[model samples]
Target: MKNDTVGRLKMGYLPLAFVFLFFATELSSQVNIADPFVLRVDGKFYLYGTDDKKPNDGIPVLVSDDMVNWSGPAGNAAGKLALAKGSSYGTRGFWAPFVVQNNHMFYMYYTANEKIAVATSDSPLGPFMQQEFRPLNDSLKEIDPHVFIDDDGRKYIYFVRLINGNRTFAAELADDMRSLKPGTVVECINQSQPWEIISGNKWPVTEAPAILKHQGKYYLFYTANDFRSPAYNVGYAVSASPLGPFVKYKENPLIRQTDKIKGTGGCEFVTGPGEKLYMFYHAHADEQSPTPRRTLFSNAIFVPGKAAGESIFQVSENKVFLKSSAR
Candidate 1:
């Protein structure tokens, strides 16, 4: 695969390891959450994602009064939410469900069998009901749906779609959040950058896009490279507007595996009760294992100086420490 394409494919799950490693502990008895999508509601923390064990079973949920201590069996503690009736398109199990609260409704955006769908519920922990069949774009292979609601009460859904044969496209959703608006699907990045193109074979890449708007500028963090390869890493792009004209970070691969955390990528950010930003992700427990199991991790995001335009941020190794005791 081409190097640029490799980077884009690896983006799906690499930065997540940085988050999991940040909260690493000596206690071996604690439960680990992988592909975690965190939310703070009613003064409590709720995490929803798939358990790493099966990767193709039902989606898992974990509850914590505090972010530090997460407790649950891999598949037992919480209820499993499956595809709604008439939506049996998923041959494989459900994977990567991201939830957002809009107008007193909890909307879950998820991927199953490489197609994206939406489910709705009243509570964060939901017996969610699927409401859509086809993806926003009928022609594209859709996966990794991340819903972003801007400050103006306008809703936008960002996700990875296959365009051409060897590249991924980032597109915006309609206000209904079910279909892509005309002229909204924009080609954000291609798998042809100098670092991504490799060995004369360009890998169609790009997945797991997480966006954060801070101080009037939009920052898009994504994973790249082959998910099954050791070279998988995370990269970033910046845009003046959410719709893009995104400029790639000069020092791409913002977060990657070093000697400490082996497998990386799949990252999402959450703000706690006190307005603290925390990045959550997953990584492999043992880099050398042929079939390495992934563990969830967390880290902090910081901006050194306030500037316009675009600047780069780096993901570094953080000492694992208890941030809060279970309430």
Candidate 2:
């Protein structure tokens, strides 16, 4: 009878142990990756963004097997490439680069001196070669280039143009992804909105525009206020078309710094395995001295029923404990 009881107890404990092990694996899979840009190409994932250090002069790249733990700065595979001859702009350090692969060729869109440029590479970890120095509206001082390929085999580049005294504008790229198509500039939003407009500030500012298409509508996400100021925050606007007539979300400034946390801005969104949405950005370290030395943080973005749903860009509770896990 005692042997029978022991057998039953062992079976119960076996299932319990399995459950614990499964959760442990799932928890281990959740890693803290900063400035989180996730790109999946040919069955592999690549992440690119700014490192925690300020005035970061180099582009940092990370690769992951399962979109969890990342492997590197990809071992010196990226840097500035010479601008093509006769291209008169964008000859400087690379910053805030976003990479995409199409037709087995890799393209990197990056910002320098508030101008956006394009480079191409045969490999994802690239010694990318510069193809053009100025790829957007030559008249506009633009930055934070985000490229999207729509379902109709059409390509578009979405970026923020600081114009008309420091307001943000959005424009579309030509199909070739090399330059802005004529008459494609659409003034999506300006600092005129009561929430965007600030008192005693001569410059109305908005920048870092990222676009995602969801359920027949396009969502435009951006940041506003002076990045160096305490008021830095993230906001969103929506449109039925890629180039819009964007409607600012009633709840503008979706995420901002509170008394507890300081210096919150620079937003990018990525969808990971299991269709999970993640927001990647940099913030000031709460415990570290001299807050300018910010660190990267990631948190799950919750959206429901539509692609333009609300987002919360806060550091995950577990992320606070995650030491810099980069290898």
Clashes by residue pair, model 2: none
| Candidates in order: C-alpha RMSD to true structure | 7.4, 11.0
- The per-model lDDT (C-alpha) reads 0.58, 0.55
Tens digits of per-residue lDDT for model 1, 1-327 = 010111111112224443474446445344444456776778876677655565565565656665665654322213444333333234464666788776687777777666777776777766566543554445557777787776665556667775543233556667676666777667665564554443544555656777777556677877766555555566778787777888887667766466756546667777653454566665655566513335444444534445554334545455232232232
Candidate 2 lowest-lDDT run of ten: 1-10
Q: What clash count does candidate 2 reach?
A: 0
lDDT of 2 by residue, 1-327 (tens): 010111111111112332344345554422322334556665677766544452234455667665444566563342332222223335443456677777777777776666777877677676665543454445657777777776675666766666655455656666565677777766776664566656677877877676666555677777777655556667777777877888887766765455655546666655544444445565555534324334333444434433445332222332221222435
State how far residue 133 of model 1 sits from its true place (Å).
4.7
Error of 2 at 138 (Å): 4.5
